[model samples]
Target: NSFGSCSRGCTTIDKLHWWGASIGNAGCEELSTQLVSASKPYDGKPARMVKNLLLGGNMVGDACMGALARAAAKGALKDVGALGLSRNSIGDAGVKALAEALAADVLHPGDLYISGNRFGSTGALALASALSESAAMRRLERLSLADNRIGDEGAVTLADCFATGGARQLESLHLHNNNIGDEGVVAIAQVLSRTAMASMTTTADTKKSEKGIFRTTFETIGTLERLFLCTEGAAEKPQEDLPPAELLPPLYCLRTLNVGSNRASTRAKGALAGMAAQRSVECSV
Candidate 1:
């Protein structure tokens, strides 16, 4: 079987050709087993090495991803840097399992491809929350979440993550055809604007920038949240104003953001206009 042949590479072979010759969950099960056996003794002997696992083009669902997460937690697939799940049926449940691992710091993918899946806002929020809470940060350089339905709400959540600099190491983010609108576009534009401002300014306070264009409209809201968290008397005290860019999340390392093919809303077009005018990053929308 193609799966069997590919498994051999983890032990004692050098080949990249593998075609699943079975139907149903046979391929997934076989590959899952082999991946768990990676760098571990096989048949009383050591096999080759498999550092990355590619399981795209398979109809792997949530259950299978859960199994993979278990294996990853057990240190069976410790060296895997990439998780290719493109063109699959993974939805909210599946991504939730993956988010669990990411949240627990059990898996740190260099590249995560979940495009063409059935994930929605729930899944997006789950992943965003996990990443926001991720320890040691993600090694993710490229992330493909395009072609899903993460709507405006999900888009805002993700934008908040970027604004907070949670995924500063990320390089490319693909969200095309994700049913985004002006609200989402505007939120993302704010991120770009903040990033641009951060680049031009020398201080940590985006509002202190001599640019004179710096404003704290967004940051003002965050301040209110923090105030609400303060003790009774402390909550009533006014806090120093800061620009949203100053409170920007960890996204100093991002390079490209693709949000093309989505329905643009009138409200977001203005923000998009400024972003488009600057053309600072290699963004496509």
Candidate 2:
């Protein structure tokens, strides 16, 4: 059958939830080629494939999406700088495959944006842990995980991973609309400070700054450029409150902050503001 005819048939059978029929109509070879082609859009070209890969809202279910992601990784789809796989019907299998794909050496030094999928707190945590263990993830510059049901547990798992040495390469992180409350955020802040300190100190810099502002410090996470915490009319409610400085050090790298749609009080905002003031870290509430 022609590509269009095969694709239409596959869609029809998939709508019936008869994955077997869909796979039959598409044929293994054709499906494999299509998936590989979609994954590696520019395989032979000199331009790298590190730009962006957005496969959200496709409703891919069962093993189909997982297989496709694996194929992409095996094909050596290099330079996939940004990947967005949101709103798909991803289950444990899909999650595992996607995690493996992201952790693969073929995709590195890029941004990963995942949200609106069927990944719950457990799945999100699993994926985050896998990414943390991957050498590829260490090269990431940005990560987005919004609008998912990743509760405090998932948030903490991700926080712990990001706090580790592997996450030092990250410059931007997005966790808006997740179930991360004050405790989770606080954990993340603590890690950010540690990473920033590691990035700042050198053998030559033995003297402390008079203003306490170490220019050599990378400020591992001072501020983000864009943060979307509000969901329309629900901007005023403060969800959680951070602890005192005695509990954790300040994160001097933050620039922009967004804390909307939660129970975040004015006091919490003030505390965040106080920390940001020194380094000009923008605060949003």
Candidate 3:
């Protein structure tokens, strides 16, 4: 199972694009060894040439994941940007290993796509904790946990993580098609409300900076997110499966709110107007 033979043809000594090299049959031992070996070309300099590591559609089991995590601990894949582990059989154990790597600032991927792997609430919680504990996680922008077995509990944990630190720079998040309920939506709304203020303040600071003000206090977005409270692709048939508008708060602030879905649009619109009535500032709902 040594990918040694394919390693030569698969990797171009300088760059490697073996998207599905070993795939399902490739275990952790070979890959970890491969990664560690990849970091050996330079005697004193860094041998991190692989920027994107796409090892999806395989069953890189938990034991192998531990090995991969160890390899990462040694700065084997330090320069990896994207790590794709979709369609694999990675469960909570495997996810925990990866999370540990992230928590320790060992594996730093700009984008992590772990969709379709059979990881559930535990895995989600582990990942949330990892992201929360690591400041290095701010480099990560996109995260996808769709089609997993994550329920309200995991969703809430993720929301709390978002509300806290380590997720300020996160932009796009995919958590649809899971067992998330109204509680989860409320948690998401809460995150949006909490995160919006700091985001807006950061933008204000950026404007001040542009105006030649020497004030360095708060961190801001490279691409600041504007507050937009509106729903998209409105549902017409009154989908009962969706969360209730009543569960949301009066203000229901958002960075990008989209609540025009279902038969309750008029009621929500009125509610939004009522909430905005007392406010002196001008902010669209």
- TM-score on alpha carbons, each prediction: 0.72, 0.59, 0.67
Candidate 3 residue lDDT tens string, 1-285: 111233322555434445554544345577678879878756777665566666666566577678878988888877776676766778899899999999998887766878777788899999999998886765565677766777778777887776665444444466655666666655655555444343333332322344455432234321222232123211121323222322222222322223222122344434433433432223232
- The best candidate in terms of TM-score: 1
Candidate 3, residue 14: Cα displacement in angstroms equals 6.3
Question: Looking at model 2, which ten-residue stretch has the lowest summed lDDT?
Answer: 225-234
Q: Indicate whether candidate 1 or candidate 2 has the larger lDDT.
A: 1
Q: lDDT tens string, model 2, 14-63? A: 11112223232124335535545544437575422323444455555546
TM-score of 3: 0.67
Task: Give me the overall lDDT of model 3.
Answer: 0.58
In lDDT terms, how accurate is model 1? 0.65
